[model samples]
Target: MKVKDGIIGLLIGDALGVPVEFERREYLKEHPVSDMMGYGTYNMPPGTWSDDTSMTIATMASIINKKSIDYNDIISEFCEWYENDAYCQYGLFDIGNTTQLALINYINGNPALECGPDDERSNGNGSLMRILPLAYIKDIDYETVENVSALTHGHKRSKISCVLYIEIAKSMIENDNLDIDGHIKIACDKIINYYKDDKELIHFKRIFENDLDDIDKISSKGYVISTFESVIYCLKNTDSYKDAVLSAVNLGRDTDTVAAICGGLAGIYYGFDSIPIDWIDTIPKIDKVLSLCEKYEAFCDEY
Candidate 1:
């Protein structure tokens, strides 16, 4: 299944980035990551992933177990993973601030849809990092993407970025041969046209106009916009799936997230087989991932 490519590719990217998450690009210039070695940032053994994969798998489990994309079930799954450590090997190790607060809001009796902070400052990459499942979902729209994002981050910029990401992922699934630059242009134009009246929509216009080949000011941070731009930059600049994910990891801070997010796109465009088999074996709990992929494929078939 292409969803396997998207999810497992993302998990592999997350695992690859875990050991060197906070190291700067300049430092990585000296000691670059050649494989999925561990014991750097989080001090875990090799193959240990962070909240990026944890939440992603949680969401996937939610979709499969609930037999639908019910936001409440998804939120509950996130909570179960956060509090009960479901699907994660080492429990929750790296949750974003906004996600923590939003989970708290949910635990404190806030409506699942109303739990997230709507403040502009709350725009974060937490929700965006684990939103790949929606790409495989049937009959999804920008509003559904926003509501899902609203379970953690409620800002328009974040919601819009998620929509654009899902658009690219879905488009990639439909036409694997589509040119990446052209695909991005279509997604950007479609999103910009939909949200043109909003002044904030101008923030993503560069993605519409530029192909990221000449951009010298890329930031690899956890903020939603930076994460979105960084993922795009990595995808557009790299030639292969390996290079695309490596480019994201070497960009530094928030490495797992940046790579995981970019990996979904690279996986979709490059195909699942393009991901290195050695790297795939290096991930822990491969059986679980395989089972989830099977479940997702069967669910899609039935849907």
Candidate 2:
């Protein structure tokens, strides 16, 4: 599994599902995105991606140019990109209310750390969705990844959730002999340690550590913890890249974003070859994503 291909697969999946993101299951059943041939509600031509891909690309671009995860740089790039309508189709759709509010606060002179909600309820999946680039950077220790997460997402629970997902993805990519159960146990332990006092963390632990077999039973809706857990569930249960994403996309709410996140990790685990070629061919930014991957791979080589 070349890491480049894994990244490419992620971009492809994100773009392919963007147009049909929130359509009901019945709607999809009638017009299933069975192939990456790219037909969906947005009525976009086959390759347009939503905020998922744009933010990820922004993250990747920051790492490539800065050679590290600089929070200020990422925010600047994100705002600049959004303002310039770089993500044209996605801008037409509503940005998350929390994100909009947070960005507004940031723009109005609030400290970046203080921009997001102080309450536990501010746990949207925005942070997790844009963190995949950290999974690709090289030589920087796990401490760097954790620090970067905290910088972008001030909430400890949100930071920890991003850390866990990155750790799982890194283990899969670097350790051929990685044990999934062992990885999950380690992640769960670390998450518990970080948010031991929080009730949401307790609830997350109960749902995550249980013997729940249904992927759909796991909530992939919108909360950071739930979305992270759902992605983990999809990764653990599915046998192939196709099954992993299909399972995630079929789960009613927040389907596209969940599938994109799961698809990115699964692509890394299963390798790019495991992803369908048709899907790769259909991504809107195929050339651009591949270029970034190549540049990232070169950067990894240097380190």
Candidate 3:
């Protein structure tokens, strides 16, 4: 029941903020988004979702159809699903250059491992944004999360960030006996153990542990590092769904993705009850998402 609620909460928060994403904080102050029924924006209407939910639904669809993570197959599914206008109401499908290049390369027959660029710069939050479904599916197993992340984003940074994020959600969902500090410690210890020798991972861990005071100083850009930081910030500071998402959305850059990622973690921590009922009720495609949840529940029965 918690898993079902968590997934729904994620989509609800993602869809709720679609219209206000990237709008200046001043504008939101003057015209607050107090509900999800609708918000008229320059280009889209209220209740529209962005790539966050689109890719999430694609991930869920792949799991339902294939019954397991297939790297190449999921990539193909994402491309076909996006191109076919499956989630067209989300506005322009302007995907990131790295993801677009990797997809194009895969279509031209490049090996999945070789599709992504060798440069570390390609490690963006794009990988993490589409990965919440995996958290609920694997029940937060570190090895399983790492394997799923490597399927599309094989870079070391991408893989580590993905693993850590899902582990956070997993710890929250599975550890009824533990408190928040215990969960954070367990997840951080696992991450440190996994990449103890890797400099980037070490730097990231150090930043997470010792740099609470400088969170605003840390970049909130679209990179994986920034997204990870933002998630930690939202988790540590906010007490409710509204505070968590509103704080993330106001963090200046990459607002939607940050809110989506933060909202997923916060949803797991606070449970579905923390989310506003009115927002959840009005989210677009609520019935379809509920159907997908039912399918996932059936699949879990077999496992």
Candidate 4:
């Protein structure tokens, strides 16, 4: 699999939703996001990505530099982005509350693995948004995926969401012959078989059962479960990468995170060439991101 196909796919989706993030579903129904927009929520120009892409890039950079998945170094890279705006397109303008608090915990002497809050309320999409890169790593284990999610969202529910997402992405990367539903079903079956007895599995019944077609049941909120559901709903319902992400953006709240998550899968399924060139051109620092993807792909190959 080409690293840029999924990574840049995620970047384009983030840019598409940055302008309309937090908008309610009702508002977006009348004025849907059809293209990349600028200067709306964050007042930044079009094609500007948010913390989702920054944290993702930071993770890849740390892995390449350390030649391994060093949790401490990865957290330090996140701190660099949080405090110094490293890896941002222009500046640090957006971040989830859970992520911000976790970084502060790390800053105040907490260990990288212990920095995230374990409270039930801390289950935002912060970890899920950046966990896509892990899907590309060869022989990555579930425990490592959990630890990475625990860096900002330690709740078991949040960790499970990240793992399930990675499972789906890995399916796409490894099994290109399957249709979208086929890929999702394979991942869902695995998650069900692995985490069947966990209490959090109850929360994932809709996904495990492939029950995401109803729009009323899907949500576009910041909650990790809702975000995961939205990603699946958007992907299952749309035909192309552009349609999938645009469907996600129009769902409104937490638009960037949902689109980013969905776009990662769509990018892998459709290939990088399927993404619109105009949208790719609007993003600043994209060349640097592409360079990082090359380096990260090489590291994964050698790992």
Candidate 5:
């Protein structure tokens, strides 16, 4: 149920923003994304999802098939998505530069864990966008989450972002009494305590210490920090699944990834019923994603 709640939410958010991924915030302010429209950015149909959903599905499928976190298998599935378009509905698009480089590193024989570039500049939302499924796995740990982020975004900042995001999602799944800010505070406390000595902690000071209420201060760019900040801002500001993802998309640049990440958390907290039925009906081949979610939930239960 958590798998379906999160993944389908991610896909809806991805599909909603596919047609306006890179439009500027100023532009979106004038021309907001109100509904699922088509063909503006990618020239695809109304419900076509971008690489965000595809890579997420690839991650879920890999886990379901292997029944364990096989790093090689996971990267192989990513390769399949990049080269063969196995998980995509309308061929691959919006592949991040960092992700492309890491997959190439894997193709050129680098180990899965080492393929990602570890430099500070390599930090992007590439890894965080697809990390939701891992939070559903019981007993999943920080190192494993870090390893998965290292598959495409090896920077310490990126890894910490993924871990923090998962901890928030896990909190949402396990506790219904907490509000969004409460769940985020719980995750931040854990991260701050564990990574107290790490330099990367400075990068998250705004999220860890501040309320992130200033809409003007938020950046919805592709940078990992920016994306995560944008997600937190949108989640804190909005009260429903629709408003959360819509706010993310309207923030403009990097619309799909931010919305996808926000939607994953919003879906879990708001519950699947909170998502609009018409939005779910719009995505093509949604049943496939739903079916995968069922299998993935089963696998996590057994694992």
Candidate 6:
């Protein structure tokens, strides 16, 4: 259950999808991505990743350096990366609209938690994408996950999505054989139980519904529900790490993010050994990624 296994696996997915980000599904069907590619959308090299990995790494560094879930540190790190191009290869080329707005609020001296918009439309996959690290954070609470998600997205749907996703990740990391559908059902039930008193369950109707029957509803859109369903769909349908992530990439439009999110789950379920060594080698700054993985492993043990 090495955290970096998921992180690097996610980066591979991000790198693979970066090139073909807005290509339609029909276009991708005709021109399938068989391997990690580059220089199409962002025109970067083969191993370069987008804001997904950068923000995920920022969240990881905040946990490691601060030894806790420090929202201030997380926002500061994100600003550093956004302003100075830190913690990424070839600099920050892309960012989500909600994230950009939240960072702007941070730059204007608003508190990190207050930065994100609270509207329903603010429900992009921005927070959900980088939340895998928090699943490995020691003694993390669902409130902490909510707070983390709120740093960039203040909607309840976004918070619930993070909480559920992290719970699923925790389940996979701790128990290899946990049935995906059953585990997800349990996780969703718990979410419903926990939040039942606070808000109507209708807002998160998608999370409560059976996703297998709603496979047609899944997509690579930037919406949190779409990403959440799409990731789970790819994981359920594919057996190997390669197949899971490639399935995500083929969804097209927001390809990098969908694949990255799916790759994170697959990496945990399949173990680091499941990831292709050639894919691992092709990623830029492989040594650095491995170093982070080691630190994350120790972090998990200590706390």
Which candidate model has the greater TM-score, 4 or 6?
A: 4
Where's the lowest-lDDT run of ten residues in candidate 6?
210-219
The RMSD of every model to the true structure, in order and in angstroms, is: 1.3, 3.0, 2.7, 0.8, 0.8, 1.5
Q: For residues 90-192, could you state the per-residue lDDT of candidate 6 as single tens digits?
A: 7889999999999999999999999989899999999988888988865678998999999999998899899988887887777767777766777788888
User: For residues 112-183, could you state the per-residue lDDT of candidate 1 as single tens digits?
Assistant: 999888898988798899888888877677898999999988888888888999888888887756788878
- Error of model 2, residue 293, in angstroms: 1.3
Mark the regions of model 6 whose C-alpha exceeds 4 Å error after superposition. Answer: 197-200
Which has the better TM-score: candidate 2, or candidate 3?
3
For residue 91, what is the lDDT in candidate 4?
82
The TM-score, computed over Cα atoms with residue i paired to residue i, of candidate 5 is 0.99
Q: Would you give me the overall lDDT of model 4?
A: 0.92
What is the lDDT, from 0 to 100, of the residue 34 in candidate 5?
89
Steric clash count of candidate 5: 0
Candidate 4 per-residue C-alpha lDDT over 1-303 given as tens digits, one digit per residue, 9 for 90 to 100? 799989999999999999999999999999999988998998999899999999999999999999999999999999999999999979899988999999999999999999999999999999999999999999889999999999999999999999989988999999879999898888888888888788889988888888888988888999998998999999988899999999999999999999999999999999999999999988888899999999999988888
Query: Model 5 off-target regions past 4 Å?
Result: none
Give me the overall lDDT of model 5: 0.92
How far does residue 197 in candidate 1 sit from its true spot (Å)?
1.2
What lDDT does each candidate get?
Answer: 0.85, 0.67, 0.70, 0.92, 0.92, 0.85
What lDDT tens digits, residue by residue, belong to model 2 across residues 227-303? 77677777777788898777667654676677778888878877888888877776655777778778877766665
- Residues 67-97 of candidate 3: C-alpha lDDT, one tens digit per residue: 8867667777767755676644544444666
Q: How do the residues 94-179 of candidate 5 rate in per-residue lDDT, one tens digit apiece?
A: 79999999999999999999999999899889999999999999989999999999999999999999999999999999999999
The total number of steric clashes, by the backbone 3 Å criterion, in model 3 comes to: 1
TM-score each candidate. Answer: 0.97, 0.85, 0.88, 0.99, 0.99, 0.96
Per-residue lDDT, model 5, residue 117, is 93
Order the candidates by lDDT, highest first — what do you get?
A: 4, 5, 1, 6, 3, 2
